[model samples]
Target: MFNVELTSERIARERLETRRKREAERQERIFKEKVRTIGVDVKALDMQVEEKKARKGAYVLLKADAEDRRYNFEACVHQNRQKKKSREMEKALVNYRHQHQMPSTRREFDLNDPDCYRKLDPGDAQMMLPGLAGEEQDSKSRLKRQKEQLREWLLCQQKELRQGKLRKKRVIKGMMAHSSMPWTWCLVCVPARTGESPPRACNRSFSSRSTRSRRRR
Candidate 1:
């Protein structure tokens, strides 16, 4: 009688173990389906994000380039004005020298002799044109500031490029994860999807042939 009871208990335990395995396998299948769906969704989301970022960066770069060009043009204009002003100053000094019989260069003029300063008419002497001088200095300062801003924008562009590349990589990796190619997706999703895995093509540890063999088995 005891032997029969023991046999019945062993059979019951075996049945329970089989039921547990079936339940676990069912859960695994559901999980794999969810993973595949999520992988495709993630890939789509990444692509959209990358495109948006690229568009934003392109506009920013265009504005930065325009500003850089504007600064360069202003600098050139100021440089030309500076040359014209120096020439005018030289001609004025020459005329003053001829009228007063004073030396041409400042080094030749005697600062101790009040006669040298008297040669240039105090009331009529035009000091530097305030408007022109101010404009020239303002242009130079603006050019310097714009150049610095351009450098910063260039660095930002570089960073955007890197981010764009990284996002592309993420999209590719997601594609590989969902691929149906043998050994490609299987290896990638294996540790993540053990039993009842999806038909993803992974390139994990195994070779193509071996991964296919495991899939068949």
Candidate 2:
């Protein structure tokens, strides 16, 4: 009877050990499944982060390029403006020099001529000073005098043409000088140069005359 009791206890202990091993295996399987699921989610999240970083880097590169292009455009425009201004200044300088330096007449002096600077003989004396020739002199003397005067006038005109500066003269206030050009030319140009209207004194005289005529009538 004792033997039978011992055998029954050993059987019961073996069944209990088997049940504990099965329970441990089931718990381990559940833990491993949960860990695998968490690893998959982490990998997907890492992919999303890397993609966002790549997009941000691309945007930064594009923005830098745009700024570079804008800077280049502004620099190009400034250079063009400076170039145009320089060209205009150069043109104006050329025009100013041309107008001042050029002679009006085609006549030129020959410095190499032997007779150009010789002492005055009778013919040269006649050319230099013709009024010295007497009134009793014949038509030849008169013609020589006229020719000398014409040469002097031409010389003055030539001097006026090159290195054109107004002659320094003492100013005489309250004095009217004669103009070489016609009065009609002066009448047209005076208003334009001096920015003045025609003489109001003449207008006043005319108005006074008109009023007097009306009273007489």
Candidate 3:
């Protein structure tokens, strides 16, 4: 029984020792620099980088495809607009030619007609007289208008001349009036004697004499 007990104890101690060794190994794996260093997982980071690069490449391709589609759409719209404009221009040209470019409306048709003189009525001969009577009437009217305009121009020139003469007369009259006015005299009294005061008066002749004397000096 003692040997059996000893064997059991030994077995339990061996299990405990094995468990302690495994715990120590686990701690070493968690705390050691080689196993738990201060750095990211290179494989995980590389995979993330590759994923980001793939996403960026896909975006670039999608953007380029969208731009190409947009350009093609705009080009197709522009082509359709141009085609419509060309069709409208062609239609307008065809309409214009049909309306105004008929052969009968052309001057050459009259010259080329074989019965050009035979188609004239009795009054048509007078109508084809090169409009000399109308030209004479227009000349008479033009001469009358020219005479009337010349009369009006002469009247206007005479009126302007009269106004200029009146303005000149007024200017000359103003100048003569200004020159004929009495001269202004400023009297500066001499310092009086201690007991005498002098009278102040308008002294035009005295001022004139003083002005002449200053001029002579």
Candidate 4:
């Protein structure tokens, strides 16, 4: 009876050992599966972050390009304004000198008149001078600059209008070319497909003769 009890106890211990090993194996498999899932999640999150950064970078570049274009346009407008103002000032100087130095054709005035600079107000002459400071002077300069800009803008507008005419001519020429025989001539374009025999070439002379006859009429 002791031997039988010992055998039964040994068998029970073996079954418990097997159950423990199976449970351990199941826990290991679950841990490995969790690790794999976490790794995939991390990779996906990294990809999403990289894509967001790329999009942000692209947005920044596009904004910078637009700002640069606007800056260039503004600079062009400013330079054009200064050039116009300088021209107007030069013209005014010339007219004032001509009136003072040369005798008028309609009325006889002394060519060597000493009152040439006297006719203009002290403030006006000072404003025309290189450097001066006052609120009124600042206002005048701003007005003058604006007037100069207006003239510059007008000249630019005129130039653009003239160029538009040239552009129209070019478009008309292009239209004529498109409507004419060379553009109208149909090309027998046959793409050679893979694993297929190419189509036979058509007679070029016969096709050209037909086109020529149509054009002549």
Candidate 5:
């Protein structure tokens, strides 16, 4: 009876474990169907993940290519600099050799080379003018005539100024002589209480004196 009971218990436990595994599988299928009903495709998600991985791989290749190109460019620049330095050193050596007269035939400078100057105008580059002497004589005569005219003008201006001054001096002298006479305008505006006579008294006296002087003459 104990051995029979043990076999029965073992069989019941096996049955329960089998039911649990079946229920878990059933729940997983139901959840997958619900996700499909909502339009979530697992295949498309897998493709997107694959594309992202591909893009990451391409970016890494591109970065490597860029690094390689940069290193190549740096190498080329270094080579070019070495070539330039070598050329400069060669040029300096040649110049030093030329200055030391290592070569017997030295280059000579040519002054008469036609390439040194611009082309000359044929019409304007003719010989000296034949009438140069005659033109010089004419210019000299013209200058002398101009000098004479200028001198005459200055003389006329001086003579006019001298005559004007003489006329002004004579007028001033006449005015001074008339001022001592009592009948002048100098005494007319002055006060009568002064030593000088008034205008009316001096006029009558001068008129009478003029008649007397006229009779005596």
Candidate 6:
């Protein structure tokens, strides 16, 4: 009976010591600097930060991909538009050529036509003689009209020449009247026209005036 009691007491003491050691270890872990600083799971927070960064990187990649796709779509649309415009221009050119460039409508078509001689009118031969007579008459009338035009042109030129001469005479008369000079003054000044020298009296008057002006100065 004594041995049984001793064994039971020893076992109870060992269980109490193990409970205190476990409590001490739990308190040490709870109060450690790494756990006490934030009072939360550090590894869990780090994993959350990593996950956030990965999500942001993925979003950036998606945005870049979307932008590239949009650019490609717009470029494709522009290329298609250019092709359509080119096709339209070619179509318009073809239509214009078809409408205005027919072979039968060309000026040289008659030369190439095999039936040109057969298509000639029967009356064209008979009209040829009269046409020659009419052409002769037309030539005579044209010559007469040309002669009349030449006469009129000559008369107009002569009248213009006479009017020009009269204008020159009037200008000379005006100059003489404005200067209060006589025809002798004109003849003296215009030696090329009259081939004469100035008179003695005119020379004397001009010398006297020059002397008076020099004395005044």
Candidates' RMSD to native = 53.9, 23.9, 16.9, 35.1, 20.8, 12.4
- Report clashes for each candidate as comma-separated counts: 11, 0, 0, 0, 0, 0
Better of 3 and 5 by lDDT: 3
lDDT of 3 by residue, 1-217 (tens): 3535588899999999999999999899889978765667899999999999999999999999999999999999999999999999999999999999977788799988777778978677664567655567477889999999999999999999997677656554553454433442232332222233335565532444555569799
lDDT values of the candidates? 0.73, 0.63, 0.74, 0.70, 0.70, 0.74
lDDT of 1 by residue, 1-217 (tens): 4545688899999999999999988778777865434335777889999999999999999999999999999999999999999999999999988887655445745766667556778797776765654456567889999999999999999999997677656655764665565434432343332324444443344555675578899
lDDT value, residue 157 of candidate 4? 99
**Where does model 3 exceed 4 Å of error?**
1-40, 109-217
Model 6 ranges with Cα > 4 A deviation = 5-15, 23-54, 70-100, 107-217
**Worst 10-residue lDDT window, candidate 1:** 186-195
Q: Evaluate model 1: give its lDDT.
A: 0.73
Superposition error at 146 for model 4 (Å): 73
**Candidate number with greatest TM-score:** 6
lDDT of 2 at 64: 99
Candidates 2 and 5, the one with greater lDDT:
5
lDDT, candidate 1, at 97: 81
Query: For model 4, how does the per-residue alpha-carbon lDDT over 24-65 read when each residue is reduced to its tens digit?
Result: 887787778654343357778899999999999999999999
- For residues 1-217, write the lDDT of model 5, one tens digit per residue: 5545588799999999999999988778778865334557789999999999999999999999999999999999999999999999999999998888653433542355454345457665656777754567477889999999999999999999997677656555654565555333332344333334435544323443464479799
Give the deviation of candidate 1 from the true structure as CA RMSD.
53.9
The order by descending TM-score is 6, 3, 2, 5, 4, 1
| Model 3 clashing residue pairs (backbone) | none
What TM-score does structure 3 among the candidates reach? 0.34
Clashing pairs in 5: none
